[model samples]
Target: MPAPPPHSPTSEEDIRWMRRALHLAEQGQGAVEPNPMVGCVIVRDGQPIAEGFHQRFGGPHAERDAVANVPAGVSLAGTTWYVTLEPCCHTGKTPPCTEAVLAARPARVVVAMRDPFPKVDGGGLQQIRAAGIDVQVGVCQEQAEDLNAPYLKRVRSGRPWVIAKWAMTLDGRIATATGNSQWISGEASRAEVHRLRGRCDAVIVGGGTAEADNPTLNARPPGPRTPTRIVVSASGRLAVDSNLVQTIDQGPVQLFASADAAGLQPLVDAGVEVIQFDSDSPSDRLAMVLDHCGAANMTNVLVEGGGDLLGGLFDLDAIDEYHVFIAPRIVGGAAAVSPLGGQGRNKISDSPVFATPQVSRCGDDVYVTARRVSESPPKSVSFNP
Candidate 1:
């Protein structure tokens, strides 16, 4: 390793610097759907120096790109690189960022977590050491990995990813006996849901759902900035002439299924882009959808549908966050709108299961937006969507 630069450490300033740099990571907040925020801190000869934070998708990874902004002649031969996670070494939607760090020739490397991922999994540290640089591991490892869960999940499982939306009644019901779901939630809450949809890259619904409800599927009151509409149909037929197809700015619809191309021309010609991927693997299915949208300048997707899709995703251990709307009423018939799944049992492991909903009331309806929890397992329950 090269000789260390002559300088003094600023423990107080460096810690504060790390915190401020981490905030720059949100640039990828809405854009980097499955990627979490990662920050980078660079120091030389004990003196805190250049810093970088990954802000969004297609944006620079914190360590590599940040090093670029540092004074060019300042030799990294003595600088120390600090990253929230293992630096990426695989060619992904972006380049293998490990090369970027290598190019800097930093004298030492300090990573917060072990890259359990196969592609880079320790490859970064190995590469750094190969070049005769010092490598340090496990600096705040747990917290850093927790911060970048989405990205880590994507790295481990190829999928577009999912976050569930829920709505219900005070007693945990979604609607009345006759399926009359009106005024259950108030104007303000519904309006917020619409806005959330607008920001999403697409809104996914199930096939049986489209035919049964004939739902417009468009983000209501927020339709102008309509999200790309997606329908999951195993049978391939979802009423081509519905209001949703005609009204949605981005579609007739993108269909995901094993359906024959011959039967889907009408939808295609009408303007929807149908992606025919026939697979039963939930992980594969999600990955294809996410790649399609993520590559097409769309990443964030909102799944707003009847309980079937919601429950299925939850059952698959796919939901990340939730929004549940509760109305003030009860029902008495078998016709009452229950959650996504019918009576059934699926066991869950003893994981960190908890819900924290920020309540907001509208008319007789109430809504709870809960933060994502860790270690969720499969179970039977009703979550109104």
Candidate 2:
């Protein structure tokens, strides 16, 4: 019930090791969706002896990897172990990592933050301490949370963390007045979008985008796995010949539409999975789609929209991150669509706010990344040790 300590200062050595762990975790970015990216470092006499990071889902955890790879005959008996996230204690796809730590018999453990999942919560920390190893948590907490935001969000809420991405011209138009939006961003920025797609569990779009672009939505320069392609529409009418519909044999392609919508049989016959939601409101429809994705254990979603879909998500406050690319060219037209289109906010206070705006250049385009400031922080589980 007491308030947490006021950002306790960390030692220089501890800070260095924690940052190393974070860098290791970043290497697993594209491969560890639906699971938290964790990294571990085993230190003896203030020097690192072994290091490891979670490589992929259902693979050995960071602690296990590090402990297993400790050089033969090098003892970890009195060493300290540093990890970005708390070691898991429960048995899932692999054995509990706590067992490995206990066997190593480390003198102490340093964790950036406690695991937020209810099942593991403080249980991992408790198990470590119960074996007589000292544990210190909340070191480099903010950076660690930033790295695992998607995993924390997915575990705390049923829905995956949503990122809405798009590119527009200087005049705020994603396309010309005639809906010709191909190549709005430069080749570098488009390649960056493909990299983003490779990191998410699913890439979502509106039916209009599918019909207009007929994109493959596959991760180019592909990594471990391709993201699932999802299309949302109220009418459930999609072009049967679109690349998304025609490539069902390669990967997952799903349709989320209203129950009353018609003309979905052809997609089903073409091997597309059609899910019907009973909501008429766009906000409700978005929520239903997210719920279905969550139930299927998707941890991160990318919304590459067609204006209306992005607008609905914004109006409903459903997006967590934004990756907007601004091209150098200008195309002015009253009929051209903006990145988001819906009922405009009536008051300045009603507008959505984002924080930590990071701007970078991708060739001729300016890329901006920001996080929603209104969403509550992920829940944390802790106990005095």
Give Cα-based local distance difference scores for all models.
Answer: 0.63, 0.86
**TM values, all candidates:** 0.69, 0.94
Best candidate (score: lDDT): 2
Q: Model 1: how far is 300 from its true place, Å? A: 6.0
- Please give the lDDT score at residue 342 for candidate 1: 31
After superposition, the stretches of candidate 2 with alpha carbons farther than 4 Å from their true spots are 1-9, 374-385
| Predicted structure 1: lDDT | 0.63
lDDT of 2 by residue, 38-157 (tens): 999999988899999999988999998898789999999989899999998999999999999999988888999999887789999988887777788877777889898888888988
Highest TM-score among the candidates is held by which one? 2
- Which residue pairs in candidate 2 have backbone atoms (N, alpha carbon, C) closer than 3 angstroms, thus clashing? none
**Candidate RMSDs in order:** 7.3, 4.0
